[model samples]
Target: MKIGLYFGTFNPIHVGHLIIANHMAENSDLEQIWMVVTPHNPLKKKNTLLDDYHRLQMVFLATESFPKIKPSDIEFKLPQPNYTVNTLAHLQEKFPQHEFALIMGEDNLNSLQKWKNYEVILQNHDIYVYPRLNSGEIDSQFINHSKIHRVGAPVIELSSTFIRESIKNNKNVVPMLPNKVWEYIDHNLFYKK
Candidate 1:
């Protein structure tokens, strides 16, 4: 089985996220996309991110209707401040039979050189790059790399930070988020001013 890891903090899983994940799952060779909920950094402070379980729950709610996309808490069990390369290695060790790939935006691709042990990641796994409205130029090296694939997925400009801010300002961000996710956020009074 080939799995595509879509990593995000998902403070609240919104529609734009689902669109990208769904597009990847439907358009790419990947059999399934795991919406990996990135654990909040214990070292950082004063962020609006929700609790790990809450964010994971939101992912579950957002992806419940999408069969090809599933929510993952794989990063939660890892130590804080983990890097992508380490996560990939850990996942490979845990599930040797499955081939793991990364699903990222072009923006992340542009900054790939700065990631820890990025060369190793490129050497071991494939990367499916989706379009982002605010991305910079993709690195020349990756432009034609064998392991790098540019996917012409739809450009979703919406972001979880925008949704959270809208909710805090008492604006209805329901349309921006999944129905169940919105309900959970509303019921829990999350991101309220």
Candidate 2:
């Protein structure tokens, strides 16, 4: 199987995430798109993040209706401050029979050089980059690379930060989240300040 790994903290899964995953699964060469819920991202702040289990459950609830998409907790079993290179290596070892591609946004592509062992990541895996609003043009070096493919997925400006803030401020977030995810957040009183 050819799988596209969409890694994120997914503080809470939102519609924008589902749209991108569905687009990749249907429009790209990937047979499956796994939403790898990172326990903690080395590059991001953790203060506002929900617990790893809650975040993972949100991903599961949001993606349950989509057969091509799956929620993964692979990073929870690995080391803290999870690095993409290490997770990719572990995944390769565990699933040698399958081909793995990394799915990321154009914003991430702009910062690829700063990631640990980015060279190895570029050399080993296929990268499917979806467009993001205001991410600017991709650098020429990556634009010409054989392993990097720019996918024409819809660029939704929605973000987990926005959703969390809306919830904290007692604003409605139903439009941004999956119904079940919104229900979960509502039931658990998550993100309430």
Candidate 3:
């Protein structure tokens, strides 16, 4: 199977993420879109992120209705402070039959070369990019690159930070989240600091 890995912290799996992943699954050549929930990096400074399992659960709840989209916790099992290149290599080793590609935003493309072993990633797999409002120009080397495919997905400007801050300030962000995810957060009283 051809899978597009959409990796993120998914702090609460908001609607922008859902829409982008769904668009990738339905519009691209990729047969499946795995919403990989990035595990917490112990080395990083503390933040308001939910526990890894909670974030993963939100992804699961948000994606449950989409047949081609599934939530994954593959990163949780990998080494800490892992680079995308390493994760790709690990996934390839484990799922030999499946062809894995990357799903990212145009903004990330601007800084793609800075990623560790980015050359290997481009050489080995395809990258499906979605639009991001006001993204910087992509690196020249990646422009018109055969390995890179720009998908005409809608431009999504919403972010998890915005949602979290909104919730913290007692603002209604229910429409920004999936029903189950909102319910879960509400029940848990997350981000209401």
| Residue runs of model 2 more than 4 Å from their true location after superposition | 41-46
lDDT of candidate 3 at residue 117, scale 0 to 100 = 94
- Tell me the whole-model lDDT of each prediction, alpha carbons only: 0.92, 0.92, 0.93
Tell me the spans in candidate 3 whose CA falls farther than 4 Å from its real position: none
Question: How many collisions per candidate?
Answer: 0, 0, 0
Model 1 C-alpha RMSD vs. true structure (Å) is: 0.8
Q: Pick the winner on TM-score between candidates 2 and 3.
A: 3
- Candidate 3 global lDDT: 0.93
- Candidate 2's displacement at residue 39, Å, is 0.6
Which residue window of length 10 is worst by lDDT in model 3? 131-140
Q: Provide the TM-score for each candidate, comma-separated.
A: 0.98, 0.95, 0.98
Model 1 lDDT tens row, 171-190: 98978988899999999999
Clashing pairs in 1: none
lDDT by residue (tens digit), candidate 2, 55-125: 99999999999999999999899987778999999999999998899999999999998999999999999
Pairs that collide in candidate 3 are none
| lDDT (tens digit, per residue) of candidate 3 on 11-102 | 97899998999899888899999999999889887589789999998998998999999999999999889799999999999999999999
